[model samples]
Target: MDSVLARALIEDPTEDGRLPLFLLFLAFLATFLITRTITRLIRAGKGPFRDRVAGGVHIHHAIPGIVLTIAGAFTSVAVDGSSPGAEIAAVLIGIGASLVLDEFALLLRLQDVYWEREGQLSVQVVSLTIAGLGLMAIGIDPLSDHTLSVGHLVIAINLPFHVAGVLMCVAKGKYSTASVGAFIPPVAWIGAIRLARPHSAWAKRHYSSEKRERAADRAHRFDDRYGRWGLNIEDLVAGKPTASPAVSGQEPSDPKGAA
Candidate 1:
């Protein structure tokens, strides 16, 4: 099984660089999971591991991740496409990206929000990245999933409709759904047709009072049924968040703020 998998990983029939991408996907997934596990253990104070600190500065993983990603990307670009160097570069890029993305919310806000409600954005981003990479690694062509031809004019004609659906999904604040639906048309349609989240921009601007109430009801049911489950899994994998975000002086001793 190991040998077969190895063979498959190296296979690049079209030589379009899918092999490196696949390795990157696998490495990214592994690195993120391992990093999350280590961080959780560090958070719980259950292990010898500690967050990296240097000269009174908390060294976030994003720094190293940025360096590695830049180094790997340059090397990947420079090396022969089929060379072992490309594969090695892919692994480096993958590891680096996982670290960076694991703390994406920090980069977004220019602060340590790792253990806050805002931290959830990092997980969401990472999840979408992984899913998108996985799909591409499997050689799924994007958009219409086929080369353009005169026979496929319908696809070109329908492209705007799909884009509209994706836009509506984003407006509805079903961001995760929108990310997936950017590639998969059916998902976009479903999200488009569905009621926007009660607090979404679409709902706030367009929904009438009665529609807003209905949207809220639907949102509550969805959260109860599925959203909470996703959050529970996220908490299990990443560390559980604190009741409130740590203010600089409020919880200085709390390690959650250190990240």
Candidate 2:
């Protein structure tokens, strides 16, 4: 099986500069699945595994994740790009990313809230990372390919438009749209021209009171239409979200708060 897989990777034309990316994706998926399974089992009190306690302090997995990340980063930087070592480095990085992102909420809030609503952030981050890796593996180069093809004069003329689109999308709180728009100019333009999210920085800074109300309405409608579905999917992939005691009384906040 290993020989066959290796031969397939080597024979594939699109995998030329993508072997590490493929390995990274595989490692991330494997690590995330394994981690989630173990965590769930622990949560259910069905596993022998317990939290690692050192000196009466419970150690989070992210500690080891950080170390692995640093080691993988350094290894990737030090080794030849074309060497087989790069694959090992990619796998290490992927595993590290999975471990760290699995507890992303703890890192963000500086507290243990793995089962809380905030934990959804981990699912979001992991999903985004996976999507990004998938795009790269499929040969999407964002701005690089277009920039390389254009002449200096054309690039000079087009650069500002691209920048403006990206900036506008970001300001309007359209992150995923902005990311895609960076690769496909039209997507950026649409995001830019669309109404800013009501609580977004752009809306606060630039929108009139009336426009802000309209934006809020639109945002509400969008959330009502798709929010539950999105949340369900996140739960399915990353496990159900746990509610934090402090924030339990408050209304459920948007996942990408005021992005």
Please provide, for model 2 over 87-126, each residue's C-alpha lDDT reduced to its tens digit, 9 standing for 90 to 100: 8899989999889988887898786767765555565556
TM-score of 1: 0.68
Error of 1 at 4 (Å): 19
What tens digits encode model 1's per-residue C-alpha lDDT throughout 31-123? 999998888888888888999999999999999999999999998888866578889899999999999999997898798889865465576
Global lDDT of model 1: 0.72
lDDT for every model? 0.72, 0.68
* Model 2 bad stretches (over 4 Å): 1-15, 143-228, 246-259
Specify the highest-TM-score model's number: 1
